[model samples]
Target: MRNFIILFKKEMKEGARSGKWVWLPIVLMVIGISQPLTNFYMPQILEMAGNLPEGAVIEIPMPSGEEVLIGTLSQYGTIGTLLFVLAMMNVISHERQTGALAFVMMRPVSAFQYMASKYVAQLCILLISLAASYILTWYYTNILFDHVAWTLMLASLAVYSLWIVFLVAVTLFVGTLLRSSGGIAGVSVVFLSVISLLTTLLPKYMEWSPGNLRAEASNILLEGEWGSSATLVSLSTLALSVLFFGLAVYMFKKFERFGE
Candidate 1:
């Protein structure tokens, strides 16, 4: 526990130095805030950009707060995910190349402790960024669109965050398997894309897929209640996260043995 805590703090400090502490939240906030602003001003934007006949006004209907949030989430699913993968791609690989990982492993820290610390630290930053983005987006939604209940917004965020958890777990697993940051980023993106593609092509079979987490979150916002499907997906995501972390630990142990 003590070793894990120390490593976790180190990871956070590293994040600060790497500028992840600044850029991620800022980019996500921009992405999240843009949705509401864009939806609220679509008519003006169209009028200014479109070379239509004079006095021809565009009647753009405003979307609900929930809908705006869903747009924010879609941004997270794409750009946010890519940034996260890039941020984490070199988490371990860079340390290894620099011999920092060797020095750390030479101490009393075990593979489990090292991997756990990295996992928890990265998860904290990503989740916090997502929360900030969601909250700002929610605030804008309330201002520009209909007033969505705080309970619904919070509930949807909680559900949607499971996808982030699953993402970290898989990325950690891939991080352990590869030494190149570029390769890690590439493989992680491909793996995530394949999962999403499979879920879309085979929804009936992939009902419990983590890729459906966004839809489940949207459902929570619309229904304002935790549905059975959300429960299943959340549970499945948690289980898979644990499984992937365990695999990462095993892979790290093998690497340690080879280094010895």
Candidate 2:
């Protein structure tokens, strides 16, 4: 436990120093900002274009402030999720290639401890990224609406955090098994793409598969009934996260460090 804490702290320091935490928030900010910016200007932008000749003056209604905020969260939330997927898609492979793992492995830590610490570190990064996006969304929305559903928004953020963890676990598995970051990223994308294709082409049973979990959440947030199904999917995704992290640990154990 003490070793884990020490290693985790080391990981966090490296992440902070590398400006690694900046990418997701920056992408999310653009997404969040786009909502208000577009809502505020879109109508005027359309109106300024001198009266359309005919059948071209599409009636574009200005979005309500609340609606803008929700749109921001949903839209930017997805962009942020993709950014996280890209960031986490290279956990172990990069470390090994750059000799970063050698420094830690040489120290008296067991392979399990080392891998677990990395997993936890990735989890922390994902949580922080989600929290940062939530904060930005709340701040921006409050500026325009002056009143927001803090509880519901926060709950949504929490549920989405599980998805980030799941992706990180998949990343860890890829990074550990593959020797190159490009290889890891390529494999990850291919696997996810196949899952997505299958989910679309297959029957209802495959609908709730892991690849479709994020899409399901978006549906609930945007159009569907947020009932038992959402809760079930979130729980199932979290369980899969645990399983993937464990698989990462097992593979890390099989890895022969400091050798060919």
Candidate 3:
């Protein structure tokens, strides 16, 4: 426990120094804010950009607050996910490449502790950034459209967070398995893309996949419920995260010795 705490703090400090603490939330906030603002001003924006006749009137219906919020989440599903995977792709691999893992291993720290610390620290940053972005989006959504239930929005955030956590676990696991950051990022992105495509194309069978979390998040926003399948998917995602973390630790323990 003490070793985990120490390593967790080290990871936090590394994140802070990397400017991830500042820029990641900022990027998410921008994505959140843009959705509502664009939806609210679509008519005016169209008038300015569309070169239509002077008498032609555009009557675009404003999207519901729920839709805007869901759109914001979709933005995170794409750009935010990519950013997180890219940022964390080298967490373990870089240490191994630099011979830092050898020095850390020489101490009393176990591989599980090391891997858990990285996962927890990265998960913390992801949650904080997503929370800030969601809150901002909710605020703007209320101003532009109808009020979204706070409880429902928060629940959606929690569900969606599980997906992000799963992504983090996968990133770390891939990092531990692969030495190159580019390889980690490429493989992670490809895996995520394939999962997303499969879930979308085969919702019945893939309902319990982590990739369904995004759809569940949108469903929660739009209908305030995710039904029975959400529970199954959430549990599966949580279990997968734990399994990935364990795999990462096992891989690190096996391969870290070769770094020396």
Give the best candidate by lDDT.
1
Per TM-score, the best of the predicted structures is: 1
Q: Which candidate do you rate higher for TM-score, 1 or 2? A: 1
TM-score for each of the candidates: 0.97, 0.81, 0.96
91: Cα error in model 1, Å: 0.6
lDDT per residue for candidate 3 within 67-167, as digits (tens), equals: 98899889989998898898888788778788987789889888888889999999999899999999999999999899999998999999999988899
Q: Residue 179 CA error for candidate 1 (Å)?
A: 0.8
Question: What Cα-based lDDT does every candidate model obtain?
Answer: 0.91, 0.68, 0.89
Q: Count the backbone clashes (under 3 Å) in each candidate.
A: 0, 0, 0
Residue 214, model 3: Cα distance from true site in angstroms: 1.3
Per-prediction RMSD in angstroms?
Answer: 1.2, 3.6, 1.7
Q: Taking the tens digit of each residue's C-alpha lDDT, what string does model 2 give over 1-260?
A: 88888988887887787677887667666776777777667766776776767656556665554566567555644466566667776567667778887777777787767777877887887687667766676676667554555665565566566666777778778887888767777776666667657867884877455655555544544452465666777777788878887888777777745222
lDDT of 1 by residue, 128-176 (tens): 9999989999998999999999999999999989988999999999999
Q: After aligning candidate 2 to the native by TM-score, how far in Å is the CA of 102 from where it should be?
A: 2.6
User: Once model 1 is optimally superposed onto the true structure by TM-score, how far is the C-alpha of residue 116 displaced, in angstroms?
Assistant: 0.4
